[model samples]
Target: MGSTEDTTSTTYSDASSSPTQPLLSNPAPTYPYPYPDPPPASEPEPTQFLQISYNYGPRPIKDLPFLLLFSLFALSTFAFGIFSSVNRNPNSSSVSSFSYDSTTASCVKNATTSSTLRSPTFLPLPNSFALHSSSSSLLKSLIWTLVITLIISVPFAFSVLVLLKHYTKQIVYVSLPFFVIVPIFVNVYWFVACTVSSTCDEKFPLAYRILVLVFVFVIIGVIVWIFVVNWHRIELTVRIIGVAADALSRNLGLFGVLPALTLGLFVYFVPIVVFLVLARLNGKIVAREEDGEYYCVWKQDSWVPAYYALAIITMFWSATAMVEAQAYVISGTIARWYFSKDGSSLKRSLRSSLRNAFGPSSGTICLSGLLICVVRFVRAVVDNAREDAPGMVNLILRCCVNALLAAIDFLNKFTINFAAITGEAYCTSAKMTYELLRRNLLSAVFVETVSTRILAGIILVLSAIYAIVVCVILKAASNLGVDSYFIAVMAWVLLIVVLGYFVHVLDNVIDTVYVCYAIDKDKGEVYKQDVHEVYVHLPISRNSRSASALVARTPLVV
Candidate 1:
């Protein structure tokens, strides 16, 4: 009995203590299982440099600036040459402006031959530093201020909007008493201030006249509006802005203070000014319906750029004028101020400007001149095509554009009669937009008054007629025991062919990138453009090169 009991106990203990007991049980164990949470859907960040790669298509337009600047330099030099030749005592064509002291004598002697005579060339324009303000600060400020101010203002403005919904309510009845009482209080204070003995003299003239007019107008307008049914809600918008300013200040920091005011004024007054001017001068903006209100609808989506472009044009005109003014004015002032001192820098700068008037920097002036041609061509095409678009604004703007183009054409026809330097279209939206277009047109032109662009356009025409001649010459060379002409010159020929194709392709691709789709990402901000237009820039490329390993996996998004 004792032996059997011991065996029974041992067996039970062994069975209970086994490692596979869970398997033996009804439910199997689940050890080392994975996490229960679902994976989140999210996009990964792209390499920073990839954004810049996608910004400019293929390679940048480099030879363009060389062309534009060179042509400008050449034209100016040619003009001066013509002037010098005509003004020379004996009217000798031998006295050309291309005569530099080193190569001057040779140039003067070789003026008759196109092959030997060199076209004037110049370096590109120095990129200005003033554009940094809009770049470094404007975007940053917009980002920090936009959300805070707009969000906070929503409640108060919406409350006022709700109030407007019940226009016939007692609430509308009370606004009158407040407006009337406030004006009376203001009048009383003004009268008290005028009667004060110590401060009366300073304020008596302008203050009294302004206060009396305000008192009279406030009394009359408020009184008239109270009795008048169906009051215009548009007039109460100024009050909404005041409330919004209060809310914005309460919620956001110091930066938020100005956004409320600026945004409100821009939103309200931009249309006001646009419409008023269009009404007066017949500009090209048409009032169209959206949601319920009227807005200035441009013919093409690109025409919206006209608004911004006009503004940019005006702003840059002001900036350029200011820069030119300051450059010359400050330069002259410094020369006078430091007359007793060394004055070398001042003197050098003055001489530099004067020399630039007749020197290599005429390239920049010529570029400016060239922009005039481009602007006119584009304006002409857009204006003429959309001449019958709706709205008085469109009609007026079209007329203005037509006039501007005609004037430019007149200048082109009469002023030096330059057909070689004149055909134009551009996609220079902005530098950050990755549009780079420049041309060294003078290279072919000064050679024979025919341009490279013109030559490219005519290459198709010449190909059909001159192809037989080319084949014949190549055949002759092949037969002449000249082992293979291409084999001898393959490297240089390939390089030229590759580089020329590269430049043309780069220009076309970049222009397409800018006009069709432009994306600019700065800091953490993304700017994806839905509407694209012609933007002007002096061509430049980012300094990133040789980082192929990076910027390849994911495309940068704006």
Candidate 2:
């Protein structure tokens, strides 16, 4: 039976068939041994495999034209500022008419007599106490203080990195508890002291006491709320930090690159500072009378204010660009390290990342940088308005502007990270990032709140301690008088900048890891198993069945 069936089918298949009909129609029933039917003759099987070629370089230069135009404008404005400064004559009456002799003499007499410069008979002095004392000594003290701060902060930054790497969880736990307890202890101590000391009762009136109590309660509530909400995710945050530290430690070359970028920024600012100082020389000195005294004031040229505005805007843009550039470099480097199969490519990754940051992706950085600068500038404007005119309207405007600034900052964070990884344009990267994060059930706000608060707390504590240490050392070593306060303030600022950069690098690392993890989850692939194992605990949206399933699987550990 099988032989006869096969012979009949073969004979029919061999016969000339109509072009419209397939000869193998219903071929499955032809043999006793069931045979599978062939595919319809109209649809041909694909013979050519789709090839995906990866291009290593020459990425489409995003926002290049805008970048170039802005650069040209910046350079022209800088030149104009320089020319205005150089052409102004210091010996001109307008420039030299304002005499400081009387003020200087009064200050000197007050200093020698050990009396306050604010004697009723004396003209009002500048707000800075340094101005009332020996300005030269104050300047010297500030310079020395900053120098000392830099020396100390470098080592401190390294120590922090080491601590973060080895004892992230311990630090978080200890610091958070201390942070909570210290405030409570201080508030209690204050209340007790106020109750016991009659002087405190007189100094802190009922209204003041009530205000302080309210402020304390509000702050404590906020702290407690943050702590409670993020408690479960603390471990995940630590793991993220640990992974960042590990990646950074492996690619130590980033450390070198960061400082170089900073130095470059400093170098770039030199001319800006010079231009700012010289730009002031562009105005005409006009004679003016105040308090029955005639003094020649330099009235700036009409264009000077506009020029100043331009310079200021340029500075903001440049500063933001430098910061964003650093983020890009860190993100690119860390993302590369995260995806690479081995440590052999560490140096190569850093180099390539650097090239991409400053090369093709630079325009994207500039675009984002400009946006942040504009937002910040507007916020500053609104803040000034609020300060000058404190009203509900100004306050509300300020609040709205602040919220906008924060939103931009939040969006820029991950957008730049995605752009760093894929070399996408700013808008495109932002869209893709939003979709990727949304699809993966990630909350930008939650991650930001948890990670930022923790890191900010660490930096604040370190900076405060550093400031106190510097103050103590200054008090022991020098008789700076009121200048000591100025020095300490400057020292604090320096430490914040130094430590802030350290934190900034780690922050970028965290953002990069977040984006990389999101990519992995979206594609249903694990690029870094250890990270995947830890991140599996990250909270996903309850509605996401696919994400739930993905999380349910046991992470494959190498």
Candidate 3:
């Protein structure tokens, strides 16, 4: 019994001390009941992702190629257009023999005649004599104005120079307009003097004529080269202007936007209009016949002060209203797009959008717009000052200010988007928008530089086509010869109105999309899930906080 007990104890101790295998891993096959077969390991499902590789941040270096191509295309197109315009049929109805009489403030209607009758040689003596006589007084007014301007500008120029020196900055030599302005002044004086004296009319000096021609050609060449070099930026700017105009028209179609915009414009212009009317009443503004031309002259220089005051008031009132209207329109556009509210009545949506724009959330948008407008206004003032004074130092100073203003303008648009989204103040929305942009710098750059440009270009082309169509229609319908200049003006206005409306729509669409994209990229996957794969692609990861957060929120787009 003692030996059997000792053997049992030894077997128990051995069993307890033996090495054991994990139950979850491979179990012993020889066990009484084998562990259930381990589930077969499977490979991770391939991630369905769109891989986009790009150099993040604003890449002005990458933009060089695009700039060059756009510049070349623009220059070529412009040259072709000019050639076509110059070579058009001389006998076309666009040719007119009407002469503008400044003295009478009337356009003299000449009988229908050949193109030769419209030449300089056929200009009536009464009109020519009137212009010649009036040139003396005009010349005197210009000289006095320049003298006064110079006297006032001297101290300002000195201060600008001092500030520029302290800052240790330099400006491009060409940007200093003194060299150009001086020559232009001298040339203008000489031309006017010669015209009044009638010295170069019948037997003009060939050498002088050739010299003038050479200078003009050189200036033209320089202008052409500059246009070619800066076509990309110029084109972009023009398209943006077009978009704003387009937006104005579209907003008008909606109930509130138009009224708001019109009110803003009215507020801005009413002061100036009233001042002019008062001036006319006070005999400050008068129309006088000089030779055969009509000259409207202000009776007193004192009116200038009042004019400036009215201008300032107008600018302030208009700017505020314009900003308010813009905010309302943009917010309405985004809301409609996001909520899939296309089926809703225009008046209702307009009312809601306008309400939201003027509501508590609109403070930031208004402030941002105000800041941009102020900076831009200052820049414009400085720009005009530079033209008048033409100092390198002042140019340098303005350049620094302009750089800052450009940055403000650049960020202002995005801030508006954020403001539209959350009704946050300008600074708050700007900060958040900036953070998102920093994280997704490459994407923002792509959308801004590439996407915006392409859309703008398409709209610009369409505007041109529309203008051509209008011109053709006008020509076909009209029986009498219409003035080419008049037709051109009409066409230009029409194009601006039409283009402004369409471009505004396009701009809003792009802005809304970009805002949505940026939000999704930073905050998570709401918009991405709803949008088609072509619109957006986000990485699938268990660790993504944004994506997870987004799942709880409804998608902004379908």
RMSD vs true structure, all candidates: 35.6, 12.9, 25.4
lDDT of 2 by residue, 241-338 (tens): 77777767776777788899889888987887888777777655555667976565567778778877887878778889888888888888888777
Full-model lDDT, candidate 1: 0.33
Residues 426-512, candidate 3: write the lDDT tens digits.
565567666555444544454455434433444344334444554465466543233332453444454445445444544554565
1-558: candidate 1 lDDT, tens digit per residue: 555545544544444334232210122212221335535534443311222211111222322563465444434433433433343333122233233223322222334455576878875545534455434443443343334333533453334334433441433444544445544554666566566645565747766657785767777575566445424431332232222222222222212322333354346435433532332222223345558654433232333334444433433333332222222222222222222233233334333323322233233334434555466457857766674576878877778877777654333221211111111112221221221111211211121121122223222222222233333454564342232223223322333333343223222222222221212211222232211111112112222211222222222221
Provide TM-scores for the models: 0.18, 0.71, 0.44
List the candidate 1 regions with Cα displacement exceeding 4 Å. 1-152, 166-168, 205-558
Q: Which residue pairs come into collision in candidate 2?
A: none
Better of 1 and 3 by TM-score: 3
Model 3 CA lDDT for position 30: 26
TM-score of 3: 0.44
- Say what the RMSD of model 1 is: 35.6
